[model samples]
Target: MLPQAAQLLNKIIKLDFQPDIVTYGAIFKGLCRIGDNASALTLLTKMHSAAHCKPNLVIYNTIIDSLCKDSLLQQAMDLFSAIKTDGIQPDVVTYNTLIRGFYNSGCREEAKGVLTEMLKSNITPDVTTFSILVDMFCKDGNVKEAQATLQLMTRKGVTPNIFTYNALLDGYCLRGQMEDAEKLLDIMTQNGCEPNVVMALLEDMEDKGIRPDIVTYNILMDSLCEAGQLEDAAKFFSDLVLKGLQPSLKTYNILVKGFCKKGLMNEADDVLRKMEKDGCLSEDIFLVMTFPRHYTTAIL
Candidate 1:
């Protein structure tokens, strides 16, 4: 597909066929996946004007997804407005994509408004939609709202996906509600939706009948760190090494920040040394290491 995407575009242009909606949808998705939104939108506009290729819900969703990939949230919103003005009623996908975009931009308030709009239009929120909202609430540190949205979805018979569970669990863990987090983790497995920070980690671990990945450790590591349980975080990092899973930059950053927060300069230095030794230090983590602060720094 990589070697041929440009070739396909060339063919479309040579034919002057104005790329039908199907062609537009295909190219738009490919462009978005590759983070090429400008060309995708241009093709979208061309498709919209073509009498032979009237845009539908899918085409609209495709464009929105492209805008989102480029982090163009406001542009996506404007496009949605244009979609409405074009007499095309936004469907579930339209609202869902914008909900996700709003969340991505840390605009949870806007996301909430979108949710309200969704309900007003009677477009039933699906599991994926709920999952995004749950993630947004958790990341925003609005655990109460996260829990409420979770319960709301449950009562509406929209079961939470694995992402939903992970987001909720993360919220509880951040707030030092380990017991509650564990309960939800158990229920998630009972419901047969496995957690995957990234899909490869799951399939890789499953193949060896072992569970040693950066994300699993990070979940516990983040929770423990937030709880001021550095012993647990340090131990978890070591356990990951023993299991032959190298710590990702995220894992290293978590430990470094955890130690710094505790004013344990010695421990922080040791962890930073380990990160350098393991080649796990990222630019962002390296920046934090350079700016290590004492406990009193927080008062300023």
Candidate 2:
């Protein structure tokens, strides 16, 4: 695509059609897409030499984003500093892109430093900004920090969305803080985040009028199984059907494993049959077959 674009640009130049920054930017973007940031930088230098096309903020931001995506953080930061040196003001996209790059590269401190710089510049952090922070903290198992970030987001008048709430919920769930996770569900409702949960948690769900999606049910079922509550997990499986939700392949696998854990060969076989009837293939067939046939026949 880059070669074809370059050929067309040369033809256009021969016809005396002057290519502007936007025209050059389009081709530079294609080079970045192919993971050729080095070539893209060379093109930028060419644009500098060619008087007809001057690099603009969009051009710089595109290269910066591409550099960050390629995990060249020092190069990205160098370009970021150069942007200011060149007298083009950095915008929210520039800051957000760098912050994301740092977070993805596990450079959390640098990412937060970028956020602080953005704040000092009086650039209000957007939902995407807070979402990234929340996700990063949660993934790092810093639930307390994630919760603090969530509070900061609300205090700054940035309403949390489903993704934001979900991140916090996931953080709580990861730490086995079911009580906190349940409370977050209410906060999610109060904040007008869309509903997207567990048993007794299901009772809490009913009490709170929260609807359980398939993911919610799956999480609860998995948690229950992990807690060795196979009976409760089975109930969630039944409730899922009664609620008109189809059990996912994951749902079947969880149930099979839960029953197998309890040496309930009959129940495991039943679920395997149900999974097959549902047109789902069980990846745990070896576990299923490994269970002694004599044990299954005895249970039958």
Candidate 3:
């Protein structure tokens, strides 16, 4: 469809009807969307040579983004310089695209340098900018730099979002900084970020051979329960036992309370019976026994 549109534009141009910048921009975007950067660049050149229509910042940004995504970093950089030479100031999007490109290409220093140049140009880095930097640093195992970037982000008044915390949490977990990860998790909860947002981190932990302790399981179960995923929580409990990890009293309490809260008396009773079988049914069960009548019926 985009190619057909481009052909239509060519026919219009042949008849001396020059398409406007908006028309050219749409075609450029479509071409870039399909990774046809070659055609997009050709159209950009033709647009530049046309007497009435010229490429704007948006068109240039689109092409630059495509080039970067295709890992044509040098071409993207040349176009970055070209945009400035054409008297067009590169916006935050332009810088961000290049920065992400450099990072994806393993040019960490170049990525950082782009951020520096962006600051020098007085383009205020948004949360996305900081989040990208934090994610890059964390993936590179430079959590210290990630931490510094986070601090700078806050100092610049860009509040950290879930993505920012998740990246740092992943970095800490990757480095076996479980204590720090737990502390960060606590901070996330304190800051009103949902624990379920970091639930995927459990897979990362397993992949990295980081044995999740009882506390970690408790957090996972609690998050699952809070999200109303009682079945998943129960499966995780079974997994815990299969993995030879003893379910603590708190673990049983989380599942029992989660089931009872959802009025799942049978499921809650099953967990209680299992708890008794494991010799984990103690007085501490009352702590999570919110439904006294149901608890009395189950225990009896």
Instruction: Go through the candidates in order and give the clash count of each.
Output: 0, 2, 0
RMSD of each: 16.3, 13.8, 3.7
What is each predicted model's overall lDDT from 0 to 1? Answer: 0.73, 0.79, 0.84
Ranking by lDDT: 3, 2, 1
lDDT tens digits by residue: candidate 2, 1-300:
688887788788779788987789899889888888988887777677776768898888899999999899999999888888888888989999999999999999999999999999888898789988998999899998998988998898988776676667667766777678756765554444422233444565455455566766776676777677788788778988998999998888788777776788789889888887878875455446665564345433
lDDT string, candidate 1, 98-175, tens digits:
888877877878888998999998899999998888888788789889899999999999977667876786677667
For candidate 1, report its TM-score. Answer: 0.59
Clashing pairs in 1: none
Which candidate comes out best when scored by lDDT?
A: 3
| TM agreement with the true structure for every prediction | 0.59, 0.63, 0.83
- Which stretches of candidate 1 lie above 4 Å from their native place? 1-19, 189-300
Better of 2 and 3 by lDDT: 3
